[model samples]
Target: MKKPMKAALLSAFIFPGVGHFLLKKYIPGVILAGAAFAGLYFLIAKSVETALQITEKIQSGEIQFDAATISELVSGQTAGAESQLLDIALAVLLVSWLIGIADSYRVGRAQDKNVDASD
Candidate 1:
């Protein structure tokens, strides 16, 4: 609705930090998006790698996956506490992106809504 918000939203459509760029909050937006990217990358690739390794082991009769989960999707099997933080990072990025866009828009809107306010 506002310029900043619009920009932030548009930026999110590109990556997750574009909104921050539009809002002029470069540092936090970058950190948030970078962290999200790292998390998502590890989650997808790590899970796929783990699955492949497990599959090979099973084929060779060397190891077997647990019975608790059968899907073997990419969302699971990514270990480490940093990864756990990925979820939070992703959330922060999304929220920050949205806020940046929204705030920018609102700020611009407030400054310009009145056609005669600045005269």
Candidate 2:
């Protein structure tokens, strides 16, 4: 397969910055990987916080230990500023992933062209 396609596939299937790393584009690879990881961290943190809150409520008898109630609580928690932050985190993750794939492919293609020209 072509270098560009290979790079794109690596980014898409492995991780957001894997392709850049493969292409020896260390700076972009680090940036993309960092952003993706930051987004994931925020998402996981929010989930854990929500779970703790629900658990506390359940333990306190404020909410029943049922699927419906838990679901409702989870939905309720995702509102206002918190929800907005979560949305932003999700967007960042997605955008970073996409940019990583496209930019890596472009860089790889350019490198391939350079190699061909030099040959």
Candidate 3:
């Protein structure tokens, strides 16, 4: 396969910055990977916090240990500012992933052209 397509596939299937790394673009790779990691960390942390809160409520008898009640609690937790923050985090991850793929592909294409010119 072409270098550009290979780089794009690496970024899409693997981590966000893998393609950039493949293209030897270390700085962009680090930046994209860091942004993706940060977003993922926030999302996981928030999910764990929500789970702990629900567990505490269940243990305290504030909420029943039923699927419906748990679902309702989860739904309630995703509201207003927190929901907005979660959305932003998701957007950040997505944007970083997309940028990594596109940029890596572009860089790879350039390298391919350079190789062709040198040949």
| Candidate number achieving the greatest lDDT relative to the actual structure | 2
- Runs in model 2 deviating more than 4 A are none
Q: What is the lDDT of residue 107 in candidate 1?
A: 49
Worst 10-residue lDDT window for candidate 3 reads 15-24
Tens-digit lDDT string for candidate 3 (42-91) = 99999999999999999999988999989988988999899999999999
The predictions' CA RMSDs to the true structure, in order, are 4.9, 1.1, 1.0
Report residue 29 deviation for candidate 2 (angstroms).
Answer: 0.4
Clashes counted in candidate 2 amount to: 0
Cα displacement (angstroms), candidate 3, residue 65, comes to 1.1
lDDT of 3: 0.93
Name the lDDT value of residue 23 in candidate 2.
90
In terms of TM-score, which candidate is strongest?
A: 3
Better of 2 and 3 by TM-score: 3
Tens digits of per-residue lDDT for model 2, 16-62:
99999999999999999999999999999999999999999999999
lDDT of 1: 0.61
**Which pairs clash in the backbone of model 1?**
2-105, 3-105, 4-101, 4-104, 4-105, 5-101, 5-102, 5-105, 8-19
